[model samples]
Target: MRLVVARCEVTYTGRLSAYLPEAVRLLVFKADGSVLVHADSGGYKPLNWMTPPTVIEDGDGVIVVRKRAGRSEDRLEIRIGELLAEVEHELGEDSGLEKDGVERHLQEALAEQPDALEDGLRLVRREWPTEIGPVDLMCRDADDGWVAVEIKRVATIEAVEQLSRYLEVLRRDPTLEACRGVLAAASVKPQARTLCEARGLGCAEVDLGLLRGAREPELTLFEA
Candidate 1:
């Protein structure tokens, strides 16, 4: 991941047109080929962003991101006035998701048998992409409708919010506009359940041991 603090202006043209005037902002160029421009005060949302499968041209204090969007192209241009702190970090393939051992294992287990969460639920893919981030899993229901699944070690309000964001972006695509979200976790909080119900999302408290054949993974070498 490359983080650059710069005084710059951003303009986007594609499905729509938007611009951000010159100011000090944070620009993130991710290993996944995503680019994000953020202001300091907007909570966690970026001011402008472009997702992966993009070609980025950078030189002479200007950066241009191009993507082939169907019959046309989308472009994001950044004009750098001053480049401040710029540094890159090597983050592994995790992509800031599935950070813990148990969560990672649970995702793998669920990926193998998605029907454990719901009947006829078969995985289309894992780490399904969106602008905000990737969904834990993308699946198809018995009716062949799109299902977006998010697995967490513990489900909270924030987790529900994360899944909601993924769903929002996915629904923008005409093919996935009817998509729904499901949240599976080792532990699902009451507040999270309430939020899921209100948002019309499904929630299941996944039993990790049961999913793994009634045996929890051995994380330690020594027996107590």
Candidate 2:
């Protein structure tokens, strides 16, 4: 499988140290699990500050997306510094950053990361040129069957909505007779569970404990 490694920084005010750990830890775990990449936050040591994600603050953090792929031309690497500055500017956070605001900004920025396909598995960003719209991941099995993936860092009904859209797009392809659907989230929203059941989609709640060093499971059969 292709792997990418990157390091960024966590900058938050002392007020958020408690919640910051959970957020950052979850972010690291989700990133690593999704991309098969190593992720680290520049700690408080202050000994060495390098690269784009070298700074963050309360309601704000910096992250970079890197890729290790054979097709260098297609591979995309996003510098954390650039993304951080962009997000900061977009959010207009000149003063103290709000936790919710920062989190939302980073999440939106993360969607711009690079993409790579390996071992029948693919890690895709928002910009991948896919006929099936903006897909999070496109998995192809040995039988040449395709599965559409949609991810959620925190559970929300939107996960179901996003995957539902992908399924609709996949249905347009005659080759995709039956496109499997997936919802990977840290927590499962009640509405999402209901939608998954009603729509026959596979839903999985991801956590560091479940995916620390494990590979994403293959989607064997369609639900219902």
Q: In candidate 2, what are the lDDT values of residues 38-146, reduced to their tens digit?
A: 2355542222111111221222333433322223311212233222111111223234333354334333433332122123443333323343345655665445566
What digit string (tens of lDDT, one per residue) describes model 1 on residues 1-224? 99999999999999999989999999999987889999999898799988766899998999999987767889999999999999999987664643698888989999999999999999999998777677889999999999999999999998998898688678769999899999999999999999999999999988878888987655778778
What residue runs in model 1 are displaced by over 4 Å at the alpha carbon? Answer: 88-117, 122-140, 143-148, 153-181, 185-224
Clash pairs detected, candidate 2: 11-56, 11-57, 12-57, 12-58, 52-81
Give the alpha-carbon lDDT of every model. 0.90, 0.44
Question: In lDDT terms, how accurate is model 1?
Answer: 0.90
Per-residue lDDT, model 1, residue 8, is 99
Q: How far does residue 58 in candidate 1 sit from its true spot (Å)?
A: 1.8
Cα lDDT for residue 76, candidate 2:
16
Q: Where is the poorest 10-residue window by lDDT in model 2?
A: 17-26
**Alpha carbon deviation, residue 154, candidate 1 (Å):** 5.1
